[model samples]
Target chain A: MERLNRKERVAAILKILSDNPNKVISLSFFQENFSMARSTLSEDVTILKKVVEDIGVGSVETVAGPTGGVRFVPSLREEDRQSFLKELCESLKNKDRIMPGGFLYTNDLIFSPEITNKLGIIFASYFRDKEPDYVLTVETKGIPIAMMTARYLNVPLVIVRRENKGAEGPTVSINYVSGSKRQIQTMSLPKRAVKKGSKVVFIDDFMRAGGTAKGIIKLMEEFESKVVGVGVFIEAKTEKKLVQDYISLLILNNVDEEREIIDVKLKNN
Target chain B: MERLNRKERVAAILKILSDNPNKVISLSFFQENFSMARSTLSEDVTILKKVVEDIGVGSVETVAGPTGGVRFVPSLREEDRQSFLKELCESLKNKDRIMPGGFLYTNDLIFSPEITNKLGIIFASYFRDKEPDYVLTVETKGIPIAMMTARYLNVPLVIVRRENKGAEGPTVSINYVSGSKRQIQTMSLPKRAVKKGSKVVFIDDFMRAGGTAKGIIKLMEEFESKVVGVGVFIEAKTEKKLVQDYISLLILNNVDEEREIIDVKLKNN
Candidate 1:
């Protein structure tokens, strides 16, 4: 490898840290790769930290001790978050998105890689203090956002299946009432999925009565794990929620099928 | 904003490009953000490109013409790809992973964000030339990897459901036999999900007999879209496959429940 100047070195360091968000890359690893002195690498890290802060994307923190290293903590700028949430609300307000049963067709939005990636970072930022061991979500709609959150947090993603399949070995199935449908539904997970006493964050695309979130709480109990946090993209207006203390990016006030009006806005706006 | 030196400017530019993989960012956008001369910004990009190449992660590509811009094209170095796939095969070969009915339990591996993130980048590298309009997968296991691939490709992810729900508005449903189970199953996708004449790539965790892949091909036909490529993490040994010309990372020879042994290896190794 050729000798790289400070400009090139900073760019390389940022790229590596950004790729492995929340995962520490040892200083020795960088030193071995770049063939730079410890002090020089430290100076480069300081410069990189300042650059990331100036850009308002996130911050680079240095850990102390034997395993100490540098990590990139991702964050969305305040103004960027506001504008993004507003634009998302505007998109959801499109009348065509309202279906026959007043369900908003959010498949395109939720499945969008760009949108979910940002939402994941937002969710990660909110739950980073919890130091979650895993990010959990049910099958289908929530998986993308949950997967993104896990990626940003540098944790594994655990998906609870709607039903038990023969291939998953021994499984634990739990029955929970659907908040909106008022019907009993079964959700299952492989017995080996979550570790005992692990802390997990639940993330999903929508929440109506928070029944699923509650269900997750009960399911986590089977493995002796804890649901430290919950997050969703949209929370629909409901008379009551089964669970509380969850972050939602958007609130859906109402979807008027008759008038073809959909009222959605950023949460707490 | 404070004026940034060359090192800081290079770090910021690299961060932006890395975050928006494969999505072109105009030179003017960088110029406006950095408040620097176009020539100077170009020099930073050039330095960043050389730095990325030195690191062997990927390349910074420059597009020409009126819509010209720079984009990050992520790639896994050949050695890294080989070692990662090899490690993945070893993990799968654990005798405990063999469940009843000769099924190998893979939820932990497929659901892992770190593993799936790398798999996504590898898949993106393979299908980037296709310029896929969307990365498509069925509900459940494949969503994580598919989402990652879409993120890396800078495209939308479209998930097909096993059953149609009222929330998706109008949907097109089709029945395809499960290659391994040899049972017919249904898959449905909303009409608005895919655009006409667009190209898409199908990604999944496992492929046996390729029935699901064949079904995806048929389903895409309903929307007048083309299935340009297929990629999977594992492919089981079978008499034959329903579809041809797909990429599989690992080849699963057998899962011996009686002997508690699993035989899996890297594809074409």
Candidate 2:
């Protein structure tokens, strides 16, 4: 809800595209949509190209005369992604972000196409060479970024639902310990939802105990496929345990069910 | 999932903007993501500007000089929107789009953000002026465009569920006849989910017998809110019904229940 400054705005915009990983937008197209002065946007574009490159997940390139604008290509280093996600985890602990079930409420950011799109782009850049066969996300909220990122990657999305739809198919389902609740919960994905030997990117709106992520990892393995990477819209590791090779956009620092003093952080690359 | 030609691609992108009423994109920013050569993108921008104007629901203008690009501000004439929707209905009955359930399957367009975004933009352009307080849709698939349009209008989204959730307070429940069977089915939304005096835009992924949309409309009125407009990702209206005042992005015409022939028509305007 806070207004983004020029620097943040540019970062945010680029982040949206990077996060999008779906359809790429022409720079001129963006200039038209955002309605900023051409020179200002040009300057911002220049800065974004540099920042994204420095971050190491990707590079934003400006296409030349006649038909080109800027397009972010995947060029990220794995270390950078890890560090960036680490920073993200730190920013998610804000008291305001605490929700029921010890979940870090990142509704504000996940619901934001701008922010979510950038996250998509970042992943796109991070995983470009890998080329995952599909994207996986769970029910309710994760659908946004999962759908957005799938668009960027040009792949189909398979959703894991807590309940099965008789219409979808008979399925392989799992009941896992939900970290936030420390209670086991059931979720399922259709057997045909994903194919074997294909590369996949696993993502979700939030990752606490990593139970769902791990469950999905196993489910994906059932297809005999490889997990190219894991990304979370927000990470609350301090509130729980985490595994390696996962990306978290934001993190939670401290919490108080009573006073609710909170701190938030973003993974720094 | 299908490849887009130049004109279709351009139209699709513009449609995304128009789909969300208050959404905007910077032209330069757009150019960067698509990897388009500037000149070609410029021309595409020009065409988008012109065609959208002709549609009368909005105007696409250029912010010139070093930083400027095109921006679409919806000022669409109501008559233009209505007639465009009318023609859309006629085309939907075509044979190419038929699927099971007298329903017109528009999965082709719905699956493409390029198309959905544009449709969202067009609908937003028309509905933003209506000053709707919230965008409504039934759960599962309908959530995407609903979220997109809500973001465009900078409003909250309230989703209806076929069943009640524990987190939601006492719910306002209603029933309507579904095509799945002539038998009536129940639907619900939280008691505090919507505010009174709010203007609502009803959105759905599919509209068959107009069951879900009508149920949603009734639910809103129970909250003392008005159903300002109804829009569907896909519409299969054979005969104009009392509920046809709303609009649809794609129309499904003539249905062959036995043989299964569905036709699709996109908005001609």
Candidate 3:
């Protein structure tokens, strides 16, 4: 195996901390596994502390107690976190990643290390920024992106099933208009999935009419938690007013099924 | 703007070449634009030549005439290309990136800079292996990833539409079973979109039934081209056998709508 450099080593360490959320690990644990010296490990951790501040709600708290060593408490600047995530969205904005209907292909981007790495960084950044209690999205397609986002944020991403999730018992549902369906569809979020006052970021793959995003907004109201922000792969710019404080990698302004014209451009990071 | 290292500089040059698909730029143009010395420019060109080769295409080439400096012929290796993309995929696989329904959120991953660097590297690696002749996908959701894949391979992504595109004249469409609908839906491709004998890599956000992939397959058949492979973000394993010879980053096997049981695991690169 190849040895890691200081930066790669530090990145790896922070990633490790970020991975095992809500846990404190001894610096010695990393030192032993990496076969790195204590001083070097300490320096690595220091670098991690500094870099993570830019992108992760991530902090390395050194514990002097018997059980404490270093604990990562997610926290970071929203600008830094947004910048961190903007990179992933931009990469997906590449024309090559563009799929039909001017959609940005999250499936392919997630499979790529570069895109996924940014995904982790973005999530870690969010963890530092919003400390969202949970992640939220609509079903099927939104599942993957929401999972990834939640994983990074070290929170669970809950889905609002458009279709009945039989196991959730009698569910709470609301009807909202979908641009695709051009009508109302029943959208549901599990009761008690999120507590009141909890913060959340809503994520979905493609937002056309944004009926789904709005539905989730109503669902969040039921929990009394704030919708921290909204994120999407492809935003149908026509629905710009669907939500305030939203981010999208690519905005689909014009998609003509007859003309076959797809106008795609990068959105604010 | 900050000055870049040799690797980033070289990658930037390749991007310049690919973006100008319709025209060829002489070395002098690059030299004048970057304000670099001749020897440095030559070395950069050499590195770029190798990068194009690594992406599995000969699209980048050198013209011998005085007016000729360098050009991209767009040839590459398919297998190496997809593997190159593994880096981004692996990065996205971080548990932190998981949101809900075994889904991964990649908006930030696609937009961030440092993460985009990793994404660029992963994409370059995948393109080096994939060397596809054309990028393919269904409209709307798959665009971003497919566009990125198409870009790394230095090829144009041809979308298969589910509805008619008026500008393209009469569209060609086929019916296939959708895992989402469990019923046949009409899908299409432009008549002149792809040439015969072309090699294509099918890409999308999520794969449930493989029906969409199969639809792309049938659409490509209209042009008598071969479907090289399918790449996706999250594969609901239960829906496997929807298409053969496909790859994905995550596998979601146990989906229990009632219990909210969603098990996601990373796929081998």
Candidate 4:
């Protein structure tokens, strides 16, 4: 194989690193692939890191150790994040999106790949340092964003199904009260879905009183795993929250059922 | 902005294109972003396309004329695809994945971002030319794969919930029989999830008798949309299929319940 020039090497390194986000690629891996010396590869890494940080696309962190290497951490510009969230808030304010029972219709917004992808990047960037073993979410609406977050973090996504079907083999089911509705709801997960003592991040589309989020925390406890962080795309403002210490991209202020109005704004955080 | 060298330019182009797969990016847009001439941008794209194709990472297609530009279509090497699908078959062969009603446990596999991402790339590559308006699936287990396919195709994911909730606003409901058990089931989609006259691709985690796929086709009809393609990660071999003409990566031949054996193989296609 012909040795690649610095320019070609840099381009190839960026492609490989970005594709496998948050994954550490050893210096030797790049060295052997590019047929370059350690010193040369180090120089390449420096240039790539500087360029990436300068461009505000992402950051490349180099770990110092025998087994350590460079890892790409994706990040969106603050300006870009604000603008994207503002646009999302706008799109979510349509009158027709107001459903019955003071619920706001956000399925389309949550399911749109373009919107979900950007949200994933934002959420992943926030939780990058957590280094979760998996991104967890209950089945249904939240899977898209949760999957994207897992993608960017280069981790597995474990979904806690609403009900375990026979196909799941043996499952662990738990009944939790919906904090908002105060109704008992059951959520289940296959025993093998998650490993014990693993660290996980919980993500979902909406958080109302954090009943489901609380349920997820308890569920993770059953697996002997720890929920490192909880993130939601939208969190409704309530008189009280069952679970605090969570992050939400957007805050829903109020829903006027009679007027068919929804008030949504980007969270200050 | 400072001028970036050929190496930096190529790296940036690859990142942007790969991130927005199956979407045509106009050259002028790249030119403006990179502050490069049309000729320079064209050369950069050429280098990217060649490198991508040579490495079997993906393809960069250039469309000429007024509305012409470059599009990145993701692909996996034949060797990579075969190995991945084979490993998946091995993991899925566990007898524990079999349910009492001859159903197979696949929620974990489908929910795992690592496996789902690879499957998404494969499905996206197959339907890249289909130019789907949306990627559709019934809710729950299928959401992850459908979301992934939607991500790769750069389209919105429209999920058909098993039951319509008050939060969905107005929904279109349809009754269909579960082919395997001959039980009637209802699937519903929010009225505004899709647009009329749109083309869509249906993706799911499993297909026993293709009843759900048929239900999706009927649902799309209600929306006045067309299902351009159907893709499933696994399909069980049955005496008869409710719907044909769908692509499946793996085929489940049989599950001997008494012997606790499960048989799975990769689809030749």
How many pairs of residues collide in each model? 0, 106, 120, 0
Q: Model 2 misses residue B31 by how many Å?
A: 21
Each candidate's DockQ: 0.86, 0.10, 0.05, 0.63
**DockQ of candidate 4 (2 decimals):** 0.63
Judging by TM-score, tell me the better candidate of 2 and 4.
4
Sorted by DockQ (best first), the order is 1, 4, 2, 3
Candidate 3 per-residue lDDT over residues B1-269, each given as its tens digit: 13444443454455456434323578888776566787997877766554444333445566777777776543324454455455555565555544455444454443222232233323434444556777777754454455455545556656666666443434587887886658979986656567788888887767887888888887788878888778776677773466767877567665454454445666776
Name the runs in model 2 displaced over 4 angstroms: A1-109, A122-125, A168-196, A238-243, A253-255, B1-58, B61-71, B74-111, B151-156, B161-196, B237-242, B253-269
Candidate 1 residues B1-269, lDDT tens each? 57889899899999999999999999999999889998898888889889888998899999998999999999989999999999998899888888878888888899888899899999999999999999999988999999999999999999999999767888899998888788999999989999999999999998999999999999999999999999999999999899988999999998878888888888972
Docking class of 1: high
Better of 2 and 3 by TM-score: 2
- Which candidate wins on TM-score? 1
Tens-digit lDDT string for candidate 4 (A1-269): 25666776677788788888888889988887778899988888887877776566788889889879998888888988899899989988888777777788888788888888888888898887788999999878888899889988988888887886757667899999999889999999888888999999999999999999999999989999999999999999999998887999999999888987789999998
Model 1, span A146-214: residue lDDT tens: 999999999999999999976788899999999988999999999889999999999999999999999
Candidate 1 has a DockQ of 0.86
Q: Compute the TM-score of each model's chain A versus the native chain A and list the values.
A: 0.98, 0.64, 0.67, 0.95
Candidate 4 similarity to native, TM-score? 0.95
What is the Cα-based lDDT of residue A215 in candidate 2?
77
Q: Evaluate residue B146 in candidate 3 and report its C-alpha lDDT on the 0 to 100 scale.
A: 59
TM-score of the second chain, each candidate in turn, equals 0.98, 0.61, 0.63, 0.94
lDDT per residue (tens digit) for residues B135-161 in model 4: 999878888888878888888889888
Per-residue lDDT of A136-199 in model 2, one digit per residue for the tens? Answer: 7787767667766766676766667788654444468877777666787888876656776888
